[model samples]
Target: MSHASPAPAGITRRQALSAGAALCAGAPASAARRKPNLLFIHTDQHFAGAIAAHGCADVHTPNIDRLIARGVTFHESYSANPVCCPARTAWYTGRCTSESGVVQNDRFPIEPAMPDLGQWFGARGYDALYAGKWHVTGRDFTPSFRVLSHGHGLGEHGDATVARAAREYLRSRRRTDKPFFLSLGFLQPHDICYWVFAHTEPLAALPYPDLARELPPLWPNHGFDAREPETFRKNWRMGRIRQNMERWEEWQWRYYRWSYYRHVEMVDAHIGTVLDALAESGHDRDTAIIFTADHGDGMGAHQLWQKMYFYEEAARVPFVVSWPGELEAGKQDRAHLVSGLDVAPTLCDLAGIEAPPDCRGRSLAPLLRRKPVEWRDYLVSEAATTGRMVRTAGHKFIKYQGDGTEQLFDMRADRGEMHNLAAEGSSAGVAADHRKLLKEWEAHLSPSPAGRLTGTWDG
Candidate 1:
């Protein structure tokens, strides 16, 4: 298939095809049976453990749980970046934030030369439509997708409006003959940011009512680690911690947790609306649905509030892939390490299209099909420009470029990441191994000149 016009300034069709070729080599033979429509449902700042299916008992996400019931849940999923723009950019381009030139929120636009998810799929005869937040860049979504709705900025009800637009499109506009790639980016739980901002001032705490019983309890890792790396300590101070955490008392923190979960529930309701629309439209069975988030909020873990930290609360996110009867259902794959970078290539692989050669993500098609395949031993996630994390099966290692500080956690024994084993004599060999792995991983990244210096993990 020919492109609609010349490839953008930096992107070449040859490079795109090369990426696709590498991806296609591993796709299942059954992928040729039929092309499935793609329904990508993305949310903002949703923690991986927030959903009941993922073992969170506090939050109610029936709609998202429905997807989990019908799909494969990746228990160990990390974002490409802990910030918004970079993480979403990773999903769109199948490349890491550094490679895609969007390492931080609003700091860099997606390189025009990069072929986004919509453009790549659209060129392959799919109708790519997008609704809600397109935070990677500005309002120009022409080449990537036909914008159905860009919600009103910073308003609480915008997510509902975004869902309504997506529902309408799924019901009336989708072309049946050609496959469609519909991306629904909902903004909700992110509103907790506003809540945090509003509470920053010294406001009197409201009396705790019996209704407070509904709120989630403080996470076990709520206390700050005295031995935490200096970089992370500095980040906590630099982030909303001083403005948000320092002022709040224990009950206030619990209230904050309560508010965050409510916001998640709010978005889950919007998600249910879209899921109902898809089912009513009679296209539910044939469409491959993916549910994920850009990144996760801290949810009071380790006295943190928002993303851009390497802690599990901020870096990990929910990832579910569902294609009824075609892929494995109701199975949780906790053994494999997956990243947000894999979304685009996985979608392309499912659709039997070639992902761009420049993409760094590997397709999850084999895992979905329950086929035995060689997967990565570890995964890397970036926190804007400074922090880099590498997670193996048992341990997680984090290094920040700013102060050369480090953190290491044995995920199996310390799931809450309360202990930093990086400085311990007993864990020295493990830390060294992870550092070597990160060094090797860094060697493969193709960051732009500016991004290269913006804290690419050199050690």
Candidate 2:
């Protein structure tokens, strides 16, 4: 197919042939009630706190703000595993890090039997197409998606190419009876990691001293709870950048934040183009847009530089689901706790298909459809090898294997997580409950047959 209307730009085996061919016998009659197309747009290292619409005053996100206005934004959603490969694996396979063997970035391969959304959807008659980043470790995007653009290394270079390709696809896509599942993996705000690397060493003076007044102030959690588990403390002091980050002057940290917000704005502009293209193509109403990130950047929170930590800055991400005129708009869902694990299940539910077997995440379709459903009371996120975080309605509990040192905080009163309530006698009951929940979660997992998770176990 030729894409000329504009730039806007995965396959799966067992997926060699089009499922649409099999459905042709029944497709003609159902042309009037066609399936809703799915547009799954994800970003890297973008936090909920970075968007202007999400109450952050740091940057202008007219595009994301508009998306929020057209959709339901979940303020409390989080990454399943606060790292690129693991979180994305959870998203595509609906499995936990342990189950997929992608315990960390570029570390391990996925279970062979696991089917990504592309393969699963394609088999069910959806045209599975992809553009931009596909960072699911060991699995080729070609096996699951029809590639649009492979995308560039840096968000500065790749994001525009991705946006243009997406715009072209939306504007000029061949109209088909079967719905299309287009997943656009954008690299952005994540580019701030490169910025951090460039400035690892302390500077004698601020690069733009005049802009000091404009740079955002350090996060309230800039000073973290020092009594962290070995998993977290080691992560803080792991690399040269992290070890040296603390010595950075207030201006330097603020400068880091100033640069991070710009990365957010950079992707926001491209997102705007994609949104405009969808509307211009007249598929805006019949399509559902699920926007989120694989994980979030530290943004200097806890004086941390990158991911692999369960700090709110790294774990928490923006999740917005929109289907214009079909669901409620401009609704902020701060009530339910959500996670990246929910991505696959929700998509399947919306398409009237049974969710993949043993899928760990709950579908938010009930909530989106205004159906009364029992919501999850807690959400879990993993970091590194042994780090585990269990977040309940009012508190967050963090622990690491073989580390007696644990941290707990009453999220309602101490959202900054500076205060440690784990050792306090008064909060022992809350801490115990959290421990039980984590144990139960671990018990339910049927871990991968081989790969990195094996080393994570100690008996």
Candidate 3:
């Protein structure tokens, strides 16, 4: 319940050790094993294709790249729900949107039994601390986490404060006996929401004429398949931003992409702050850093602007894990399917603890430690209460509750997701197979009941 700011600078060495001992007292026998400190860093609306480490030359993210060099990057990572609240709820609770009861942002609360990362880890002897945005809707982060920063607003102004708080907390750590789990909730390129709103109307000329040549081009799938499901088409036209973006010239879309990349660069610098502090505190090797995002932005893919749909730009996210010498460095786990739910379970497994009750996620600890293990073949991500995506290694199938039309795409062949293979008779069986897999997957989740959600938090 105490604030998680750095302890007083003048505390005696004896005092620090005493505090550590107090925190470790009465923990289970396995808790004495000096678990790795967890630095859970996540950004908002961060596209999987935005980072320089992931073959993305659009943005320079040296800090994220640094973490990539330190460990493995999961090439196939998707958010549980491609939005702020539900995806974050899945991350913190290790449950899907239905189980978490957070189908949309703040419209409903999380199921009471579901413990967020702060509550779950704190109860198990970690110094569960938090900074920046805690967008899990109904949960108040203070009671469970020792708060470092509560600033929740645009990334342009508030992200630096979040970084500073994390850096200070890391710098203040003088002992490792009690492992700390510091969650850095950075609001970034999410600020691109502001960028989109400000530019809803067409511009007469480029804002900065000199920088026009420096702009990154639009994504290849700028024009989309109009043969999408009824629900998918409905979401595409729901927002004013979408309606206005329809009028955007090709150059304007390029300008929007350039702005989004710049916003990413902005947050990358803030991440560098926390990384610098971790190293300065001499805990780099002992801390496991997990970097990801709640969801991703459209960034002109399929001429879309923000999340809600099951497009790759919105659903796929960057998931990286680093623990220095203990894990493989500079590698990509491209074969396995992963979800936002795996994060909480992986951290628990790495810390030698059991996951939360009914946690419907498998640990990625085996994959990270390079041990042989069977893994899940597909991942399901929910959207707008009823929209669902079942993704396998080669193909992705999408459906909505009320819409009879479904869409399936060959993800391996078309990363842009331009083709809807479900309409073809040859691929109908493949789509049916995914539907079966989805039904089987849902049978396992004892979904927490809630009223259906229809609103959009697309920004």
lDDT of each: 0.79, 0.79, 0.80
Task: Write one digit per residue (lDDT tens) for candidate 2, span 378-448.
Answer: 77787655477888889888776555457899989998788899878999999999887776666556667
Question: Largest TM-score belongs to which candidate?
Answer: 1
Q: Per-prediction TM-score, please?
A: 0.92, 0.91, 0.90
Better of 1 and 3 by lDDT: 3
In candidate 2, which residue ranges exceed 4 Å CA deviation?
Answer: 1-32, 450-459
The reply for model 3, stretches above 4 Å from the true place, is 1-32, 451-459
Worst lDDT 10-window in candidate 3: 1-10
Question: Per-residue lDDT for 7-76 in model 3, tens only?
Answer: 1111223433442333233123464667889999999999888999888887899998998888899989
Ranking by lDDT: 3, 1, 2
Top model number, lDDT = 3
> Which 10 consecutive residues of model 2 have the lowest summed lDDT?
1-10
Model 1 agreement with the true structure over 1-459: per-residue lDDT tens digits: 124321111123453344344455656577556678999999999899888777778889899999999999998998888898888888888877776777778877767788888888888888899988888853267667988888766537789888999898888854446778999889878999998887765447555587567767767888866887666667676555476567677777788888888889999999999999989988888999989998999888877788888788888899999988788789898988888988987898888877775667767787788665656778888865558888889999988877778889999999998888987899999999988877766665667654675854554
lDDT of 2: 0.79
Superposition error at 37 for model 3 (Å): 0.7
